[model samples]
Target chain A: MKSLDFFVYLFIMAGVTYLIRVLPFVIFKGKITNTFVKSFLFYVPYAVLGAMTFPAILFSTGNYAASAAGLAVACVLAFREKSLLTVAIFACAAALIVNLIAMAIQ
Target chain B: MKYFKKGLHDGIPIALGYVSVSFTFGLQAAGYGMYWWQAVLISLTNLTSAGQFAGLDIMVRGAGFWIEMACAQLTINLRYSLMSLSLSQKADKSLRGVHRWITGFGITDEIFAVAMGSNKDVSRHYMYGLILLPIIGWTLGTLLGAVAGQVLPEVIRNSLGIAIYGMFLAIIIPPSKKNHAVLKVVIIAALMSCVFKWLPLLSNVSSGFVIIICTVAAAAVGAVFFPVKEDSQ
Candidate 1:
């Protein structure tokens, strides 16, 4: 893509993303009162992160067994209330180890 | 300054996760023949992971797809609106005016999650401090990946790909363990996500739309079936 075209596309992408993020702060300056709305908003973070993680994480490592191992390790650590950095590091390490084992088997 | 420093400290894990994820993105952008600076620019301006990848795909497809790019970003990032709305409830006086705009620009999924998980209301300085290292890590990782031009072993690269999702799990799982409502929402969302991914016709929907549909459905289920106390939220 030409430099001009890149800038245009980049601006469009950035502009749209920014607007989605900023609009709520603009429109809802005061606290919301509705029970259903509050409940829904309260759950949004977990639901979004949950949906984003599964299925996608399965394919992330490109090796199903390794990815599964990573997911399992992560779940175990997280369920144990491990810190985020510790869980993440262990998960990656699990995937790397599983991948290496699979390579040796192959 | 206390909150600012606390925010910076809390941001360390997030910054570490971003570096690995953005490095993969940088490699992809380089593969498409983008300059290192170009990849860095995208990471700087748009801190979104899935949105940036989708936008980069559309950009490479052609300049005529600016409209498509916008649509994709809007759909993929619509969750941020929900997150921002939720966060507005927790915002203190400091997160107002120009500060809102700056913080909003930095509201990636991880940042929002981290901010929401904090013990108290968010302030502008806290948000600023929270986002600082991750932004630099994201952009710097992209620059390193793009400039290095494919030297990493595939196994290590693939292993690192799971890092961000691991972080995501770390964020949600503890909360779910504490709250049955959160657990239900997470389960519902994950099952729906699987349906969207593996079902024949549904699998054809773009990832951005899938995420929106799954999140809204799951969150609505939680809202209706397990309404949280207004004060608890």
Candidate 2:
């Protein structure tokens, strides 16, 4: 793409992003009534974030082994209510080690 | 001035998170044939992971305007709308036009979570802290990654690339442990996503579509089954 085209695209994107983020606040102004909708909205972030994270961790390389190991480590740490940084470090370490072993065996 | 300090403190963790993640994006962009400057520019302008990845896809394919817009609006960022809505509720009651206006600029998932979790009043000072620190971290990380890409070995880059996913797993696993309902949602969403990836019939669908479907389906199911009590909010 040309420089101008890319700039235009970026501008449009930034505008659309801002609009999606800003519009509901301006329009709704405190009129959310449906219980189900409110409840649904409440869980969207967690669900969405989960959906985003899982496939990347598990299947990024088209295999389940490393991802599974990572998940296991993450679950243990998380169950203990470990800090976010600690859990992240341990999970990555577990995944990396599993991946290396898998690579070696192959 | 106060907003600036708040943005600083609130932004520090975010900045730490951003540097590591954006570093990978920078390396990827460079590996994909983008110039270092281009990678830096993308991080500077769009400071979002999925959106930048989608944008890279569009760039690689030389997609049209509509495709670019669709990919951006659909795939990477649709969640921000939810974040912003939740944020407005938590925003300081006394916040007025411009402060409220500028505050939304810093509303990334991590920042929003931290800011909303704060019990204190959401002053402009705090909001500024929430914003600036992450921007610095994200932008500088990208720049550093672009430079590092030339010198770093492939293995190191590959290993570091997993940091964000690790961060993500950290975020999810804790809450899921306490809330079976959240756990169910995570499992359902993951299984559905796997189905989308493995099933030949569904393989043709785009990543953006997968995100939309999985999010809606999982959230809807969770809403029906887990319904938050009336008094909990």
Indicate which candidate wins on TM-score: 1
Error of 1 at B140 (Å): 1.3
lDDT per residue (tens digit) for residues B1-233 in model 1: 99899889878888888888889889899999898889999999999888988988887886788777778888888888988988898899989988888788888889899899887899988999999988998988788788985777888888988888999999999989889999999999999999999999999998888888999999999999999984775
Candidate 1: CAPRI quality band: high
lDDT of 2 by residue, B1-233 (tens): 76667557656656766887788788778777777887887777666777777777677665476665755665567777777776665566555566666667667767765665455646667777678878888988888887876565444444444555555665666677777888898888888888888899997877766767887899899889888777464
Residue-level lDDT tens digits of model 1 in A13-95: 88888899998976788988889998998888899999999889999887999999999999999999888889999999999
**Model 1 ranges with Cα > 4 A deviation:** none
All models, RMSD in angstroms: 1.3, 3.4
Alpha-carbon error at B92 in model 1, in Å?
1.3
- Using all chains and alpha carbons, the TM-scores for the candidates as numbered come to 0.97, 0.82
The Cα error of candidate 1 at residue B66, in Å, is 2.2
Clashing pairs in 2: B2-B125, B3-B124, B3-B125, B6-B126, B6-B129, B7-B128, B7-B129, B7-B130, B8-B129
Q: What tens digits encode model 2's per-residue C-alpha lDDT throughout A1-106?
A: 5776667666766666666666654444453567788777767767766767767666542347766776787778767866556666676677678767877788
Sliding window of 10 residues with minimal summed lDDT for model 1 chain B: B62-71
Each candidate's clash count: 0, 9
